[model samples]
Target: MAHPYVLLSAAVSLDGFLDDTGPERLLLSGPGDFDRVDEVRAGCDAILVGAGTLRTDNPRLLVNSAERRANRVAAGLPEYPLKVTVSASGNLDPDARFWHTGGAKTVYTTDRGAERLRGRLPGEVAVVALGPEVEWRAVLAHLGDVEGVRRLMVEGGGQVHTQLLRQGLADELQLAVAPLFVGEAEAPRMFGPGAYPPGRMRLLETRPVGDVVLMRYVPVAPGTGRLASAADRRWLAEACELAALCPPSRTAFSVGAVIVAADGTELARAYSREGGDPVVHAEEAALAKLDPADPRLAAATVYSSLEPCARRASRPAPCARLILEAGVRRVVTAWREPDTFVTAADGSGVLASEGVEVVVLPEYEERAKAPNAHLSPPPGRS
Candidate 1:
């Protein structure tokens, strides 16, 4: 049930309109911002749009930079990410640019709609029927398992964005705000009315790109994305709580770790001093319970109360090395490992250097540090 990391990318006017109501297509993004978006598209494994967008925009959705395409090829990827569309009615024009210009094309529709689209679309295109309705969850599962898509980019047409956000399926939102106003009520907006996920989205970063400003936000209650999902965050919190259950150690920092599958299932959970092994790291203990040949490990994520140890004397391999060896691709932690045990210890840097997706949620730092308050260094060195 693992799904690709979902990123919602959109450009909006100052007034939050996707475009003006004029007959011509409105250009909300500047030249520089357009290049930025192209770079984003190049990084994703697939790009998805709604049927409305396909009909209205008729976009080619290609990576325009030849250099970028070459880089993708060198990296053992296709020149362009796969193009995907979802429709309830399956009513689409075979001559649309979206059908002919992308590397590979896929259409997800209702079971009844699939029969109608199969004869209309080219033989090269894939038509998938997901139950009686177009379910986003099923579409994502197919993309991850069948299409081998890890990173998914969602280009908007209002309803699509709204549906993803409303379902808490989107991981990240990249909003490029142009310095103009589109006051027409008939114009499309970035999102339609829906009961969006509660709590404010966590703002990750903001930067100015030419005349437009780019703002990135991660979902607070994440189902999937580059950042940790709500479930991941909750698991990390539980890891911190587990730290309190560990036998207090004077020489080592008490920590907890949980290994989670890509589909948000907990694979294993462990804490320091687990099974009376004082030297065993939390991450190492958790991973020890899993089989070495488990294929799910490749897509699993490790959630730790504290950063995995980079250097340790109690064990031959550190937690960071163990995680990499286990093929866990992502790591989420509450706090960075302080230098109380080893000076200049940087577990995060080690994981990142090895190409692991490491994310640090500073909001839970205090909670993670609570159990180790006794290990704090004296106010001044003796």
Candidate 2:
């Protein structure tokens, strides 16, 4: 059930319009921002757009820079990222530029729509059916498992962005703001109305790409949706296994921590006693090895065998404090910290209070506690 790390890319006007109500497509991004987007496209495994975008924009979605394409080829990737689109009815033009320009083309649609698209699409193009509806979750899972897509970039129309964000599937959002306003009510907007993730999306960075201002945001927490995906749970379990690699501790809890980027890459990992510092928490130890200025850290999630310590006697700042300082907004932990060393320690609560999304997968609790079973209190100790 592993899904691709989704990066939603879009351009909007100052007033939050994606396009104007005109016959010609409105250009929201400048040449500099366009090049920037092309670089992002080159780095990703696949580029996706809605069928509406394909019909309206007729975008080729190619890696425009020759050097970037060469770099991808040198890296053993295709000349361009795989082109993907989704439609409910499978009504699409077979001769669209997206079909001819990209290295590979895929269309995800309903079962009925698949039959209609199979004959219309090229022989090399793939048509996948996901039940009676085009589910975003299923599309991503198929892309990750079958298509081998790790980083998926979404160049969207409004509905596509809304669906991904509303479903809580998107990891990062790169929004480029143009310096104009399209005040037409009928104009397409960036995102449709939906119950989005709670709290303000964490702004990672802001840079000026020509007249356009590029802003990056991360979905630090889920609002009403499931917090952790199956892949996230697997990573958390791996972190727990890493804890077993640590030397047994009599005073400190044996714990492990891993920092995973939004793209599912393990950025850094550490267990207790990683640097021979018995007092250093696992999350702190792992974070210390990473550069503080790394922008990826903001979009990364920290996985720990146990909840980061809210208060600690061995160190001035606890693991919870350290994780917050490291700019990690999402944390998935196997078990809540027991009062084995510190009493009334509420690491999960501390993280939640600090606006960090904390997901507890109690299914892995036993595995996480196995390494430190000796530290657990006996029955009736409470």
Candidate 3:
């Protein structure tokens, strides 16, 4: 699937200073702007930065509201967003308060730098190397594949911002310009060294925060050419299509399965197994293929439109045991079983005691009723 698009956001002085040589810098955006930022960060899957910004900014980089944190938990987002830092020159402070100050932090370096720096300091965070050098393609692939980081927010230090913009990797931008100016020839500007051609910006929204003017934009499709990979976009579109196929009646039974990686990416489109067909079910089929030996699933979660079965003649084993054996951390099922052939009310507990998380989403039962109707057998045929 295509990875998430990038959103570049920054607070700069009228002269484009991300930060003065001092740490006591005040935010340019007022309360209104800060709230808007919270809304943006809440929806993001990850936050990114260059080594330079991490060292200079030393930011805590966390959503400030407890309300937001609770909402994130309710929605099944990671307790914290993934923090990613990219470095090429092998220069980084493993002990920099910036990393330890908040959530999980990961380092991206060249194959050469990964070891050299990792060997230099033993920190709680982990490191990922980007080939033998800092290759952008490799970085993006790793983020999308291994990390599953879509919807990335690239916060910056001048050079990093310049590179992504020049390379057309940035999809959207939010720039907050403080009314004040910090003019110095040596100071880095917002974009970076370029006699470069100018790009157009279409304002999405504007607000006066403190004495700052905040402007947001989505690149005119042709401008940055930062298109979402066809695969990634297709998954989202297909999901919507599947969602629309649910019985038109609002209270009708709806059953769906969602397979999500820790990175927030949907592994495979949710679907059914063989003749069982679409409305027949979706979640169970996705988990069926996961090999018991596959370690990539340690952090995966499966959301089903129906409760897991304690009995299934369709296979040698029931999904409840298979899910627990697969080490699935959480299982959310929408409707309970009405058919005697497949019952889990008792055996589901067996798996839960083994540490698997099982949740019954009775709320969606109506949508699942019709699909299981066929399993109910013809009129008096049982």
Candidate 4:
């Protein structure tokens, strides 16, 4: 299922504390950093915080810049991003500033929580119940599918950030590191100890924002089994973009493939018709670049814009067989092969039958199909 691009945003002290254990909420971000956050909030479709943050900070979570709000409206977006919060117990205070100040509000909670919050919140506030337990995936799916939110910014209480990261759902992390230290041991921290996704996050950028340094990072580890991680989406999007580099194919579908190691290293990538080889498939070209006996191939994942070919006359061995021979056990693809060239082609089934984990994300189907649009039947035809 398609989910919003989840960006986890936070400001932490030098000692890795979110705030000091004081009577008042600790001010970690400088004025400049605060304005930067406002710009980010203005650009997003929604701003979310955990229930604990709402109660402790009592933040309105507004854009705070008139010009930025005007720009959002000018761009045909809501003046303020929708305010979102999660509470499994439905313990939110109706009079909190979070409820009274936002453009629109949504509460994601459990079934019992919904029962308690139904008539308590304002009539405009939407309360969505996600069955018995409030799962992070369910909240994200609802935000993307039902609310039409493409980009969501998560401003957190440590528990929420920890949950999202541990679940491999956070696409990006934007952390502002403050100079001062909150030495109190009982103070809140940015992340609690838990099993996070394996490997180091790819650092996107680092910059000085007043007294604080802002660092942006993206997760890179491919997800296990059939679950698609945010990193999986990033790699698949790259494959779709690579498809555009292929020589315009009339008889065959243009495709792209990437092989990534288990530790988030990209082993190889290639596009169809690369190096002027008319018969070379994307997966074949990428695999040819790596040694068959390479240790990484055993744990690597093959991401293709289109499904591997089940049958092809141009090549003696189809991509599916080549992948199996290469010792790859996991495959992520964007689109299933149409009947344009072969009838009843089932690369996915063939891979699955052999105990390979094949994951297809339909969200990228259109992108994978774009380069082959010319080969598709006309609008009125079958």
Candidate 5:
């Protein structure tokens, strides 16, 4: 299912605390950082906070700058971003400023919670139920498929940030680290004790905002089994971009492939027809760059803009067979093999038949096909 790009935004103390153990909510970010956050809110389609944040902060979660709101309206967006909240118990104060100040509001909760919140919240607030428990995946899918939300900003209260990161759903994380420390161990922290994605996150940028330091990071680990992670999408998108660099060929499809270890290390990347080899397949070329006995291949994943070929006349072994021979157990692809080059070629089927996990993200199919636009699309696809 398609999901909105989830950005986890937060401010933490130097010691990693979200707030002190006090009756009043702590202010970790300074004025400059607050303005930067407002700019981010104006660029997003919706702003989400956990029920804990709403109750503790009672924040309006609005674009505070009038000029930014005006610019959003000029761009055909709402004056203020939609306010969203998540609660499993449905216990909330209806008089909270979040209910009275946002342009639109939404609540994702359990069935029982939805029932309790239906008539309690303002009529304009839309309450959606996700079975007996509020699953993060379902909430994001609803936001993308139903609410038409593309960019989602999650300003959390601890538990929400922890859940999103642990579930491999968050695409980016923006953190503003304050210089002070909250010595209380019982105080709320930005993240709780839990299993998170393997390896360190990729740092995109770091800059100073007033006395605080703003840091941006993106996840990189591929997901396990059939569940696709945010990092999987990122690597697959890079593959699609790489496909555009392949030498234009009428006799072959332009494709790109990347081999990544389980710990988010990229082993190799290659595009089709690279290095003046007209018959070199993307997957084959990339695999050739690494040692066959490399231990990482056993747990690594191959990300391809187009599916590996099941049958090929150019080489003794097809790209799918090469991947199997290389000890790879997983493959993530954007587009299936089309009949433009080979008819009835089933690279995915061949991989699956050999006990390999194949994950196809159709959301990037258009991008994977962009370089091959002159060719006919798959029979059932545009």
Candidate 6:
């Protein structure tokens, strides 16, 4: 998977407005802070802005830092990330300076506006429309698939940021708090609205650049950052809940669980459904997709959110056995099987022979148990 980072770079006053409702004007992020914003611009693979911002600031949206540009070139990256804008009503300006910026431009519009806006704006830039309206998921897929943008940086003009945040799409947030204040209630707020899930973001550093104090943050694993004061066990529990949401497969979403590690980077994800062979379980499903021979899974923790059964009637061995044999050290789980077909009890003993530490986060059990209610057996059958 490409590095999915949505960097929210905005200059908001103490009152949280990007700009007032007067004629489109640059509210904050003065010339000195523009240079500061360049660092953020250089780090992302794509730059996103709403059409309002395109019409208002007409930002060049390129990394002008001489040192940063040279480093990006040495790293074999294009001089600039792709520039993207979203407009639903097709009220975009063609002569806007955003067209002549460093990066190639793409406008995400609606199916209704595709032909009309294409004819009106009429430029070399590509125009893509998802459906009747703008679908961010389709847009995200386009960014990752067509544009090859792994890291996406979203500079908001309120509505777009609100949409992204409300849907829990944005991953990182970078705010440059200007010394000035725009107290008008009608001004655009930095973040519009959203129910943010539990995730850890660390302040890489904070420095005063020009009149604004620039703050940079990157998402860490949830619970590792000071910002993550509360643990959203519901989101964490959704690991198995999400697995249950997928169409049922032959192998019951287990026999193929996995944790991918190539270098220190890890990708712990589940397979939705299986086709070619008997479907594997979530743990083995993801693990099977990668080469266990790859060094990545060596030291990674596989949190299956369910106890790996020691024995299964349909499958050869159990996932626990497979995981241990893979040389994985840490296993975090939710439930313990009570049925006779699977009787590993703690199951950690099987892993202990291989010197693995098992952590049972029962908080996730309720989520994993929700779907298996039918197979759970009558309460007092014993």
Distance (Å) between predicted and true CA of 350, model 1?
Answer: 37
Off by over 4 Å in 4: 380-382
lDDT of each: 0.87, 0.87, 0.62, 0.95, 0.94, 0.66
**Number of clashing residue pairs, candidate 6:** 13
User: How close to the true structure is residue 154 of candidate 2, measured as C-alpha lDDT?
Assistant: 97
Off by over 4 Å in 1: 222-382
Q: Cα deviation in Å at residue 18, candidate 3? A: 2.4
Estimate the TM-score of every prediction: 0.64, 0.68, 0.56, 0.98, 0.98, 0.57
Write the residue-wise lDDT of candidate 3 on 1-382 in tens digits.
2345688898888877876554465566678767767777777888888888777667767877778877988998876688888887668876676566557778888777786786664466778876767866566767777778878888876787777665546667789887877776666577877632143544688877766788887543111112322222223233333433454322222344556554445554354442335333344556655566766566665655556666655557666776777777665554565545443355446657777666553424445554545445578887
Q: Give the per-residue lDDT of model 4 (tens digit) for 242-312.
A: 99999997899899999999888999999999999998999999999999999999888999999999999
Model 2: residues >4 Å from true position, as ranges? 223-253, 256-303, 306-382
Q: Rate residue 314 of model 1 by lDDT.
A: 79
**lDDT preference between candidates 4 and 6, better one:** 4
Q: Could you tally the backbone clashes for each prediction? A: 1, 0, 11, 0, 0, 13
Report the Cα lDDT for residue 152, model 6: 88
- Ranked by lDDT, the better of candidates 1 and 3 is 1
Q: Kindly give the stretch of ten consecutive residues in candidate 4 with the minimal lDDT sum.
A: 20-29
lDDT of 2 by residue, 1-382 (tens): 4577899999999999999989999998999999999999999999999999999999999999999999999999999999999998999999898988768889999998988887787889999999899878789989988999999999998899988887778888999999999999999999988776544666789999999999998764422223565446557878999999888789988898989777656688999987777777889889998998888888788999999999988879998988888888888888998777788999989989988888887868999999998886789995
Q: lDDT by residue for model 6 over 1-382, one digit each (tens)? A: 1224566778888778888778867458788877767877888888999988788788777878878988888999988778899887778878787887676789898987786686766467889988898877678768877788878888877778777654546666678888877788877777655654334455677988887888876433322211211122222344565556556533353222335231213466673454444545666666676676866566665656566666666568667788877777766566665554454455666776667766565645666666565555587895
Tens-place lDDT per residue, model 1, 1-382, is 4568899999999999998878778998889999999999999999999999988888999999999999999999999999999998989999999887859999999988898787798889999999898878788889988999989999988899998877867878999999999999999999988677654666889999999999998764423345445456567788999898889989998899988775556789999999998788889999999998899899887889999999998788999999999998888898998778799999999999989888887767889999898888788953
